[model samples]
Target: MPGWDDNSLGYHSDNGKFFCHLNMTGIAFESNNLIKKGAALYPCVGFSMLQKSGIGGSAEINFGHRMLKYESITNFDI
Candidate 1:
């Protein structure tokens, strides 16, 4: 699944016990507008992340048979 996130220069300040992400947060799809292209519809979830420093941050991801393709495809996370 393709993912996206905003900057993190000061996104985290240890300000609160927990942090909330912005709305319009992110989106994911099993298949695009590729029906005509023979793309099969599968389930998938996008991932989210926030880093305050290099290798420092929190990550949110989506997974499961109900959400992602169970077979016929290999998953790659970045």
Candidate 2:
């Protein structure tokens, strides 16, 4: 994970009805998976886009947060 202690820059664009949220997440944590951590901010109107690029696969993701996670599998028998 990298560091976010430095000055960060971000933006969110809108074309009348839709929006795209941009973020530069340089904050690093003491964990192997950086995606598992972040600072949640205010919720706004319309659609949004948040991108995070680093050393990790992108398929492991959830569409939205929830109170309880419904997993198809947790452990393998073999």
Candidate 3:
């Protein structure tokens, strides 16, 4: 749980919810979640697997050097 600890925040991709420290029941913010001023944030990714037979998952990372399929957000101020 990314936002279970202090100074941590996370956005749940499946349910479109946003979580902030100790907030287990996150709020619905979707893609418009904003960061507080002066908050130092970093980019990260995580994955998990369920305890079940024949369950599997994979992740692919792109560092922006290749052509993206969709238009990227370009209005970020910082």
Q: Model 3: which ten-residue window has the lowest total lDDT?
A: 23-32
Error in Å for residue 61 of model 1: 13
Alpha carbon RMSD to native, model 2: 15.0
lDDT of each: 0.36, 0.36, 0.52
The better candidate by TM-score, 1 or 2, is: 1
Candidate 2 residue-wise lDDT at 24: 34
lDDT of 2 by residue, 21-68 (tens): 334353323212334344544332332235554333333344467543
C-alpha lDDT of candidate 2 relative to the true structure: 0.36
How far is 74's C-alpha from truth in model 2 (Å)? 1.7
Candidate 2 ranges with C-alpha deviation above 4 Å:
6-29, 32-67
Off by over 4 Å in 1: 1-35, 53-78
Find the candidate with the highest TM-score and give its number: 3
* Pairs that clash in candidate 1: 43-67, 43-68, 44-67
> What is the C-alpha lDDT profile of model 1 across 13-33, one tens digit per residue?
335654333223243223223
Better of 2 and 3 by lDDT: 3
Q: What's the lDDT of the predicted structure labeled candidate 1? A: 0.36
